[model samples]
Target: EGIENTNYFVQTSKKKVILTIFENRVKKSAIPKFMEILIFCSKNRIKCPKPLADSKGKFINEIENKKYGIFSFLDGKSKNNWNKRDCFLVGKTLANLHNKNLRRSFKLVNNLGILSLKVLYNKLKHKINGLIPNASKPISDEIKFLTKEWPRCLPKGLIHADLFPDNVLFNEDSISGILDFYFSCHEILAYDLAITLNAWSFFDGQFKKEFFNEIFKGYETKRKLNKLEKDKINLLLRGASMRFLLTRLYDMVYVSENELLEKKNPIEFYKILKFHQNLENINDYIK
Candidate 1:
């Protein structure tokens, strides 16, 4: 259902399912960990897809050397535009995801680690030339600073790194499902919150302070943020902005003609990074 994977809606006599054919970038060895995390989250009452087994009991299998997987179809529509209640519900669910995964340790490491991000930035600079003229200086400076300043010692756990609004589904007033664990990895938990803030707290190029508060409040109800996490959140926010911006930028520049994915505006996250750069305290995110 995304750029990296081909998805099809499947219907059987008894139930509906989604079948996914992973693209080439996905490593074959890592399939088990992804399936493991999905099963683990489902068993812990998290709203996510569970991996279904094949005739041989494999969660995933290869047909013509292409890896494919099957998952139960979660019944809910993805809401692109969310109100405060939506924000709070997503916040609580996200916190639940973090808490549930935090207790379990996975052997897989974050493939998109700090070093790879820096490398992405370098590739971005060369590819993005003249596209955003006069944009390089500031972005370069932020990347350079974060190279040394990105925190690594914070509380580490699994996070759904791609928890944008569309990935969260709501049925009436409650969140019914959380989708897309393909990007999940072990990292600083606060960084996950930062990504959520950038995704949910901003709309139409402006920050919604009340929505941010609702989200943060809902999050704290489940997992309390430490002083360090609060203090370093702005930096983490910048890092999150950079992460999305680079990925979107790359997609926009090099997207294939027949690709079925939407290209997000990289400039949206550029503005977010700019706003985070101006923050003097964590309260800047709260009203």
Candidate 2:
């Protein structure tokens, strides 16, 4: 089956293997980077699909104008809808991932957290200025607030910055495997949690109390957040929401003409920011 550019499937033979093929769009330099991260995760005892080496003992193989690799096929099903238990388990897994001691370290060239929004704003700011008065001001204010608040709240570490539902696999009530380390990097662990919370707890841009509680509860079980971290959660949530909203908005406006990638609704995340604005205080959830 195809999910975006990556193709995944199980082998039919007696020796079953999970195959992942990436198109030419995946850069050659990034192949080794991806392998290193996966190997590090495996060595650190993280539950991910184990990479299978070829005859020469290479974990990755380039073939047929694409990058091909095999992993141990994990037996599980992806949930179409998420529940509190699922969200909690996923949250716990993400926390554990951030805590892993990796053998090798990687440096990020672009701040993926801010990249989407920066790109979107630069592309549309001129047009949006005339079309939607005061649109630019709110975005600028939010960016300035995040820039000042994010660094003060927490330092950086190994983080699974993108924890979307599709990246997690659930077997029964537990998280069996965590896949797709493409967006993984060294960043604030709280930001990772914030990203997960933004995706897991928010539905069409609104916070679902049950879901948020479950995710927060699960994360707290692994590692408790300090007062500063707790306060930063709301700010990070806003930043993360803006990141997705701006990217979706740009894609909706500029790239929607493209037939390949489906456009996401930018309005959903816009609603999420409004919901956060209505919160009387971030401390209410910490208790």
Candidate 3:
């Protein structure tokens, strides 16, 4: 009875349970890898929905030619109206998660840029050819730029990688839980921050200064940014926007029937890109 990705809610006399059934189409390698990451995040005090273990203490089960897993239901609601505090908390949480010393225990997940961008580009390039008018050249140019720039921006770490509002649960005024660890991976901390900032700072293609300040303030509380990191943020934000826009446009044209996945408007990121283009310095909002 859940809305997204073959999920079910089971109510028993003792407890309520959530069953997430993974798609069989996904690579066999992805199952254990995803489970390991989720388990690690939960153990690390990341506020993720707790994975329930079976009698054997295994967190996942195989059934019906698909994978199923149970998680404790987090109690909270998604807020439409966001403030500085919320932004700050989210930013701080992300920083803490990225900064944790996983050491050599966690296997680094690769192909993030490829999976999030390059693969999708290869699939959509022929279909979107000439259909979007002037969209092609800029999109192509951005892909080229990001391909080179992403690696140079930062190194890999444990990142939520997808921290949109819908993926978070808040109780009263603070974060109660984080959900959807499917996109969790080893990636650039700044890249993760960029994704979060793009989602948290701006609204409907417009920059919200207070919200931006709140998030940055919150993040800096846990992890201070160096001058180089600060200098790169605006451009990184533009890259994040383009990454999202590309994914959204591809999904809109190719996978619109995925009713469970919330479709994002590409134009919103485009607006953010244009807004930054007009700014002379990234610190304009920080102060």
Candidate 4:
């Protein structure tokens, strides 16, 4: 269940629903918290799925030692490429999600926090060079540099750390729904924005300036970024890239080369990381 939580769509009389089977990749205890996040977002007028309980009024059901959940499917299609307008709306919507105060607290530590990232890095430190050919050096150096550089005193809040394009659904000019909140957790809010910058603006191994500025502009329309968040965002961007790179590297190495599973290239994030590492000021991204 490393990356294999299976989700299937089921048609209902009125609308579609999604049934998710929680694989071992996700700890079972976090299911309740996930349900809470979705419900919280829905209550706040965000376009997201509402968790549906089974006939027993249980959100999480058990069968054969596995957990199951149901969600009302949102009516929109996921986007592979977003225009400038879509980026703006996504940015504003994301900021709105961050600024929202949930009615209750749900505590699940960020699995991709600095400490966890380091642990993953160390896990691959030995076989990295042999496995990927000249990949270990930059990862090692990035981890060391980020440890010394990434800010720890930034403002923290709930964040959907995995805000990639595929996880977002579009309806005409707006984001109909934000999907995939499994990575939601309490973390530095600015770091979450940084992750989006890396995901939304950086592409094809290059950073797009126009898309980057438009997103920050829309984000400011909802909640303005303070000087500290603006200044250290580059460091956050680099760290986010490293986090992804290490995770992808681990996935690539751990899986047998002979297996039929498709392996994603870890080097793509490496190029993005290298680009962000060279930028000095946050103004380079947002201004």
lDDT comparing candidate 2 with the true structure: 0.71
- Candidate 1 lDDT, 1-287, residue by residue in tens: 33457779999999999998876556877877889999998889998888999889888888888899999888887777789988887778888888887768875677775657768777778766566656766877888888789887799899888888878877877888888777788888888888998899998889999788888888888989999999898888888898888888878877775676677878898889888888957877674
lDDT of each structure?
0.82, 0.71, 0.71, 0.81
- RMSD per prediction, one decimal? 1.6, 3.2, 2.9, 2.6
State how far residue 45 of model 4 sits from its true place (Å): 1.1
Residue 152, model 2, lDDT: 46
> Cα miss at 163, model 3 (Å)?
0.4
Tens digit of lDDT per residue, candidate 2, span 1-287?
A: 22334655776657778788765434666767777778888888888878889899988887786778888777677776889899889878877776674334577533457644565577877655454455677776776766665554385677776677877887888888887776666677787888888888866545677888888888888878788777667777887778776766666667645445556676677677666655634664544
Q: List the residue pairs that clash in candidate 1.
A: none
What are the TM-scores, per candidate, against the unseen true structure? 0.94, 0.84, 0.86, 0.92
TM-score for model 1?
0.94
Count of backbone clashes, every candidate in sequence = 0, 0, 0, 0
lDDT of 1: 0.82
User: Which ranges of candidate 3 are over 4 A from the true structure?
Assistant: 1-4, 24-28, 101-105, 114-119, 126-133, 151-155, 256-260
Please report, as a residue range, the 10-residue window in candidate 2 with the lowest summed lDDT: 101-110
Model 4 regions more than 4 Å off: 1-4, 102-104, 255-263
- Put down candidate 3 lDDT per residue, 26-64, tens digits, no spaces: 355676777776667778787776678899988778886
Q: Write the per-residue lDDT of candidate 4 for residues 168-262, one digit (tens) a residue.
A: 88877778888878888888888888788778897676678888887888888998989988888888888888888887788787977654444
For lDDT, candidate 1 versus 2, the one ahead is 1
Best by lDDT: 1
lDDT of 1 at 4: 53
